[model samples]
Target: MLQTAVLQWPGRWTKKPRAAAPPQFRDSSQPASLTVKSPKLAVTLEPVQHEDFSSLVVSVATTRDRSAFARLFEHYAPRIKSFLLRQGTDPAQAEDLAQETMMSVWRKAAMFDPAKASAGTWIFTIARNLRIDAIRKARRPEFDPEDPAFVPDAEKPADEVINADQMGCMVREAMAELPDEQALVVRMSFFEDKPHAEIAEQLRLPLGTVKSRLRLAMRRIKEHLGDRA
Candidate 1:
């Protein structure tokens, strides 16, 4: 099974005793909670160290803990597969990509830095890059230079060219003003011509989250343009 393959990975024979668990995180004297809100439910997890799943990654990195890696795989694999399916991948290919994504996670576990991103974000990034590579590979046919669609467009007047450059600069400035998460969704939905559902899946966010981010981004962009005008 792919799950078995993923957990066993390359260093299964290492017999190092599992290290003692890390100290618990706390809010003052109380255990800190991590809330994960999905479309189906909102669950508040008990304060385990690194409730964001960072500790599991650390364990995998430092101890070669198969159980920790297995837990991470179980959490991320389905999400990655669902994300690929929404990006128009066929079922079989999506499954393969998901497996590949997990394998990469296993190989690169030692490189994970929780200070930069959560475990989920890092894993999804790998999935996204692999998807892009697969898409590029599948588009290998050479361009037909003589095809009518390849005909050059009429030259634009100097004034029109200047106006387009100014507009593009303004758009870029507006995008730069956005928070990273909002800017990402905006690029996926508008710049890349992907739908909100696809954006949500790829980002491992809820549908409402994608829509709200788009709405907020548009409003902010409009405000920036208005100020410039």
Candidate 2:
């Protein structure tokens, strides 16, 4: 599976470890906890060891740990696939993106600095950038050069759109501004645009409580956004 996954990667592997008598592997049993803090959002994670993939990413980086990488893929690839599907990507393409995204994780794991972002956030950013690339490749000029209505544009390239990275950074900043409980709910809301009832169920919170927190979070985000609100 690792061998198959490598082929989907955009670049060659920079590191590949030889097998050893005493294998180096991440403690899969360790409860993962990832806390992402920023100037705009202050989310507190309730998941074990921040959902376990951050350290797995670090392990893949340092030791070229295939076992750890496998765990990471098993956990996140399906979620990535679901996200792409929700974004209107074809199912087969979404499946491809899931593998490709994990391959990217393997290639870019070395750059996963926990201090800057959690493993989940880092991986999400990579998937988002890949999606952006996909979108740009599909974008064609709306106007034909031979058309009489065609006019040369002075600024903003035809393909220029809301940058996924910049928007993600802004969202993280906005999330950072929310109180812990609100931020946590906001994060879940961001996931697949999950409904509040589902989020409440996952967090074991009352549905009304979830709705109320979301309202408060939206209010705070609007305040920070001004006209963008």
Best by lDDT: 2
Candidate 1's TM-score: 0.45
Q: Work out the TM-score per prediction.
A: 0.45, 0.45
> lDDT (CA) for every model shown?
0.59, 0.61
Candidate 1 per-residue lDDT, tens place, 1-229, comes to: 1111110111111122122121122222353232222323211122223344777887888998899889988888987876665455677887999999989888888878775556766786688778767864643354576787896546866543433234434455666556655655664552232567755655567899879878998888767555332
Residue 190, candidate 2: Cα error in Å is 5.1
Query: Residue-wise lDDT of candidate 2 within 124-229, one digit each (tens)?
Result: 8788777766754643334566798787545645454334343444555565555556655664555333467766665666799889988988887766544242
Off by over 4 Å in 2: 1-48, 138-229
**Poorest stretch of ten by lDDT in candidate 2:** 1-10
Which 10-residue span in candidate 1 carries the lowest summed lDDT? 4-13
lDDT of 2 at 218: 85
